[model samples]
Target: MDKKTENFLGIDVGGTHVKIGLVDTKGQILQFAKEITASLRENPLGFNLAFVEVVGKYLAKFPEVQHVGIGLPGLVSKDRTTTLEIPAISELNGFDLKSALLEKYPNTIFHLENDASAAAVGELHFGTGQTSQDYLFITLGTGIGSALILDGEVFKGVRGNAMEMGHMLSRGNSRLEPLIGRNGILKIAARMMDTFPEEVGQLAGQELGMHVLVGAASAGNSIALKTFAEVGEILGEAIVSTVRILDVNEIYFGGGISAALPYIMPSLDKTVHQYLSPYYLSDIKMQRATLENDAGTLGAAALCFMD
Candidate 1:
């Protein structure tokens, strides 16, 4: 089959749903579908087998696709054959997913990667900003996920899970994710609101959530802006260490919380610049990723192009 004409399947596995995309070589998703994670768990064969069945389910629908790629939410082995420490999908932990896929579809090719790494690959191939060959990619959502793209490829450390930035230590020696992740951000907002009760207008009685926080920030609410600012500072401190270790010139931010990046940038930029030397700061680029909502599906598809 001609490389240019071949189509591939990309699957983004999440705790709630699995997003599948039939994509062409040009990074266009020709067809897209979703599989509810809960439904898969109901299968008697178990979640691992049920997930393997998902590939066949799609292959039967699109027989021409010979290559399939999956982006997993947690750690994958160095050989990329098994999943490890998957918090959301415990059934997949230590499961040899590659062997299952091969046994079910002997003729097809499959690629698996950390979801964050897949997103970085997606940005490399399909992003509007056109990320550089070497850069750090971070996703800010429920948890802080990160991946390193060096020389146009995912940098798997000695054990295949190198960039676990969320687990890095921050203020009070707390993990980075717990400090800036969704729940953590909400906690910060609550603290700020309690400290300055006068600034809590629309947020006075409403349930605190990311949507409400972002909305309040957009409306020029002082408390919301301050919450994001503090979050940014904490995140920035982590980035300072990461950037120094990686020595990368560009960085891209993705995921839902990134929508409030404008509110966070002021403090984030300040913190990074204050800590980094001029050498590391010369050509640094930090901006929101352009793929937006399609990042997961498109990123999974991008894995087919990695080799």
Candidate 2:
């Protein structure tokens, strides 16, 4: 058997569904499946048990796989053996997930990590063009997610879960997520449309969403442009603080909402350059991440490469 072609399992645990992929060392997904988590969440046996049971089913089906990587959405123990807190699935809090999986599959090696951090690892390994081993990764989606890569590894702070930029306090002491996340951006768009009805263009009398906002922005709608500008300013302010603390120059943005980056760039760049000094601004590199929808699955598999 070709050891290099050995299959590995990647599991991305989310609130609504769990995405599973059979990936090889080169990052190609050979097989994929998704399990809606509503039933698992409602199961009387509890989410932890239901989750384990589902994974076992996959393991039984892919008996040749001995390595499994699970990417979780919230906080995890520094030792990476237990889930400290998972907001989407509260039952996982303080659960010794590693032990549970081990009890069921004694011969397999299991790896766990924060989902955002896992994405960063995937980018480091699979991204194009001399991807930085050290960079700040930000995912703009339903919520803002962040991770720091230092010396080719996820930078876990003293407490384990580090680089949580979303929770950072921003304007008026509001959390960063509420100020610039998906909902936050939509709120800005609505307010802009309301403020400048004549400039609303395609957004006039329409249901607002990220896609609509991006589409309008692409079509040069004044309201859409204004909304993204505001979001960029707020997000850029947060990045300024993050860059100052972490001292990382290469920044990569990903996720569904990052599509608005072009619209947000004017204010984002202005805010970043306005506050940062010459030394910090000189080498700064910020751009969109290459991996898109596949990032989560690829990231889960990337966990197996971590020490």
Candidate 3:
């Protein structure tokens, strides 16, 4: 009989779609596929059961895979057995996902984690950089997601959802995500364009999307530049406070909007330095995460390595 080679199955469950990857031990994805989340929810058996049934399909294809990892969008129980308060998929809220998977695939071992934390784990395991044993990770996308890595492991606070920097209050007592997330950034651009009509260039008549803002910033549009500057300031202030509490110096930025890190850096750096003490600012490192678009898929795969 041929010796069974070790390979892992990774599932990244998002708000609208699910990313599945067959990953080897070194974090390389051998096969990849995507599924529409809503389509699964429409199954007669229900979302949870449909999800479990789908995994069986993958398992049958990769018979040697004995470990499966799943990355979720929201808070999970401390034991990692249940998903809690999932905003996007109301059906998954409080569902005992692990138990269901275990019951269906009795011979397989499963791992589950929050998507943000899973991404952090992916960085620790596969990212290209000076991977720090301790650091802060923030994803700047539709909603801000954050995770803390201490001593090369995810730091799950009192409840499993510790580093929620997105929800932290910032200027005007507003949550950080709402102020600098995707929609928030667009709103900023709109406000800037309205305030500085003369500075508007390519962005004036075009739809004010992040892509447009990024393109305009790349072309030296003054309003776009100013918009990112303000975004950096808001993000920086949050980092200043976070560093004070976590005492971590290395920070990684991911997500779609992070593509404009260059535009946000000057202000982000200035804010951190302006508010933080010499000790806190001594060796602060803020850079883009390496995985890029593959973060979610690779992150889910990285979960199997946690053990």
Candidate 4:
């Protein structure tokens, strides 16, 4: 196949698995595969070496692919040449990943980026009717990941790793992530059940999870509704501050927890409107991202288009 028309390889490196996809210019994934990181924890060559080797295998398997983009879950060097602090995969910390990959695959072009930023870039190209050049992208999953898109590009604040919303302090001086993240949301559900035992309904005495919480909310369970309300309030407050600093009006939410946007919207909207002035609230456009589950993979592939 002609290199000009060839597919690009996208690699989304997560804590547990590495999602690989063959993507085209239109953002459609032509092929996909996954590798479990857990199995490589004890590899004799070490996780870093094993990961590069796995990538090499994919490169060999798809000989037509000449461009590769990698989206990593944590901090990357300012120049996008190294993995700085990947909490989930400590083995990659301080590793010169870009150099290693280039050494092994000398003929290929590689682009490395923070996962959240990559997702924003992906949205820029693949999002449904998302033509806005300025917007804030937030991913709500194990942790809250964020990115800022300015002038059709991911804004890497002075340090390359700009939007770190997870660490932002919120109510009670606690970081935002632990308050509304998966475990935090579950904690709220559990607490709501204890506080309103009679109104708990489907959530009463059940194993707590995002699915259960969303299902209960869908079923009109009071406890579940209350849990989401709290989550929305906290998340919204953070957004208010973020918006104030960045002056961004368009916001996109993605990730697994975004599934409960309907339930959280009431509180989220209230909080934002209550805190922001008329100017900030008037033209605000907040909505869920069109590419939910595939954002990471597609976003990684989208990196190939960036300078």
Candidate 5:
């Protein structure tokens, strides 16, 4: 490696696994590793020890590394000293993580943030997001993760937990996470499969309600169209709401389930067009999130150079 390419380590700690990488300023990932473990994601002590073991092994090969950054599924406090509150990851509540990590490894600087926010910055630095002044990233996984960028900077809300669009109420019934998030799609599909029995929702994995709805749109299925209409309407309403509040024009989306975009976009656009003030929707553009799983790691890595 070139002397200038001395890299930073970016680690994405998700609910199911941890992804580690060595990334340089040029957006190249030189090495990557992933570990699957449930204990690592829940227990703060377990997570910390796992992190130290995994990261320490990787960094040992490159002795000169100066910085390390972590992207957690829940909220990373604004002060960078603690992992704040978030649903699902109940164990991390009020953990003063920065102090713990610093005490363990006194020689290196550490940066922490929510996984979606980290991915947003990663996209901003190395992906299509690099060109936009304002962009939002929504990752449709087991749950929903969202991030916002304004004036070319990642927008970390007051509590370091902003842009959580997934938890936003959709039908006044339950949160959006269960409706459109990765597992949410499966739940909808399973319910449809169980209730209706013969509908397309019976399809597996990414082939759930959203994909089925899109497939219906492609084949001119009215009922399928209605399904997307409902989801899109909800998403559109949310996007329009976001636009009014943030005035961001370009939004990028990606995740395991974004593959359903074929089904979701039409309704999403329709909802945005029908309900939002014409002024707001006129210039807004919706594009697929570019980096997928890589965004989080790269975004976490960006912390090494960003500030």
Candidate 6:
């Protein structure tokens, strides 16, 4: 009899880097490595090719990795062949993702999903869903993406594209991305620097963004502090718009931008409170993401079990 080598692999393909993991069925990431994702942007067809190389290099000794999954930042066609166009990761648009992965790993079963959906799946299975039925997982990175969890599974309204709160119109009469997304935060910071050149003179010497804003806020820079507050306000209002309607029990904020939650929570809470009805606030609780970066990988692995 042959030994059944049991192991799984999860890959997170982002705009800047790729994270590949050899993992366990219990959702624990056992080994991982990263490479420049820019290779795909320059050579769109190289996404999977590069993945294969990275997987070969790192997991070469772990032949148990017979199954693999990927998390992309765009909507996936029902067939998993397409990465529908998205604003942030433009390189993956129109790529024949499913076929490419299959071609690269003929011996492995590949599962692909939207990164937000992957994160929600991870949260549902390993992070938070074990405790609650209804929750929303928000990824606050360069761009905001989210997954809606209803009754323990990802809620895709009739069509697969639902829970796109990041694109909601909540501020400046512009789409949510321009005001609350990372670029939106940068936009806000740039405008602030332009408006108060002296107050933000130090910021004027360089580009403005979440990192700079967080630093300035931490050091008591009023302008940057105000910018983070504005982001929190806009983001909170947008989130409230969706949560109030869904009446979910909780919201978990994650992603790169979420690292600055401490800087934005005040305004976010204020806005959430203002828009939420007394009954809703009393029942629903908003909190920061606890899983951190692992949500993407764990979520990607879940595609092996979930649609």
Listed per model in order, the count of residue pairs whose N, CA or C atoms clash below 3 Å is 0, 0, 0, 0, 2, 0
lDDT of each: 0.92, 0.89, 0.90, 0.91, 0.72, 0.75
Better-scoring candidate (lDDT), 3 or 5? 3
C-alpha RMSD by candidate, in order: 1.0, 1.3, 1.9, 1.4, 3.7, 3.7
Q: Candidate 6 residues 1-307, lDDT tens each?
A: 1113366777887777788777776777888777787765556445555555666665466776766778887776766667787445665677776776567667767787788988877776667434475788888887788888887777767657787777777655777876677887887887777787778845757666677777888887878877888888888888888876677758888888888888899999998888887887886667776668787787777666664
In candidate 1, what are the lDDT values of residues 1-307, reduced to their tens digit?
6657898898999999999999887878899999999999898988999998888999999999988889999999988889997999999999999998999899988899999999999999889887789989999999999999999999998999999999999999999999999999999999999999999988989999999999999999999999999998999999999998889879999999999999999999999999999999998899999888888989998888877
How would you encode candidate 4's per-residue C-alpha lDDT over 1-307 as one tens digit per residue?
A: 3544768899999998999999998888999999998877678999899999999999999998888989998999999999999999999999999999999999999999999999988999888855599999999999999999999988889988899999999999999999999999999988877788889776666778889889989999899899999999999999999999999999999999999999998999999999999999888998999889999999999898887
Models ranked on lDDT: 1, 4, 3, 2, 6, 5
Candidate 4 Cα deviation (angstroms), residue 65? 1.0
Name model 4 segments beyond 4 Å from true: 1-4
State the local distance difference test value for candidate 2: 0.89
Q: Which has the better TM-score: candidate 3, or candidate 5? A: 3
Q: Please write out the lDDT profile of model 5 over residues 1-307, one tens digit for every residue.
A: 3335668888887766778888887668888888875766644656656656666776677677778878888876777778777455555678887777777778878888888888788877778544575787777666778888877666877765689888777777688877766555545545554665555442434444444645655775544545555566667777877778788778887776666676778879887888777677777888777777588788888777666
Q: Using alpha carbons, what is the TM-score of model 6? A: 0.83
- All candidates' TM-scores? 0.98, 0.97, 0.97, 0.97, 0.84, 0.83
TM-score attained by model 5? 0.84
Clash pairs detected, candidate 5: 214-263, 253-289
Best by TM-score: 1
lDDT minimum window of 10 residues, candidate 1 = 1-10
Query: By lDDT, who's the top model here?
Result: 1
Candidate 5 Cα outliers beyond 4 Å, as residue runs: 1-4, 39-45, 86-89, 190-229
